[model samples]
Target: TWSTDGVINEYCEPCEAIVEGELVEVPPLEEREEFSLDGVTYEAFNTSGGLGTLAETLKGKVRTLNYRTIRYPGHAAIMKALLNDLGLRHRRDVLKDIFESALPATLQ
Candidate 1:
């Protein structure tokens, strides 16, 4: 039962090593602009908060790095539409409230 399979061992290494290793700062998200048929302009930005931070920390240590958000498939579309409708594109507090109201809290 003590077979040291390299594949399994490498895959099962301590998550703490990646989670607690290095701390890095995340740069601003990359953005681009697009216009709808009605001439409504909108800005699209990447979801890079913790992901960017982790990528910076693991830049050289890991071969590849990426970040993913856990949300409903249409979350972005819903958010964009809400922001456009409310004219609160850059309002962080309002955005936070809108999102928080929609998503349940994992921890108190």
Candidate 2:
């Protein structure tokens, strides 16, 4: 969705480097966020936010099913970039700060 919408430009520099294969070392950062867990690092590129197109394709085909952990637009890419740039696996608060400062709030 984001790619089609040209949202990649909104992604942070670190994420762009990772996607371009310019980042090699990933380490821990001084600040961390709640979602981040110690002893673990994350790297991602265009990870699905949820079932995505599958949800529409499977509409009405099944029942009693649920899915979670759909990453917000550009969130995963930025996160991976942050992890690699900051040398930390998880920096939940820092990530939050970065996004909050960079992105405008949306009512939707």
User: TM-scores for all candidates?
Assistant: 0.38, 0.30
What TM-score would candidate 2 get against the native?
Answer: 0.30
- Highest TM-score: give the candidate number: 1
lDDT score, residue 79, model 2?
A: 55
- Model 1: per-residue Cα lDDT over 12-67, one tens digit each: 22222132344332222222334354564454333433343555567558754433
Write down the worst ten-residue block by lDDT for model 1.
7-16
Assess candidate 2 and give its lDDT. Answer: 0.37
- 1-108, model 2: which lDDT tens digit per residue? 123222322232222112122322222221222233465443333222233355445445644222322333455545556656774335455656665677776665
TM-score of 1: 0.38
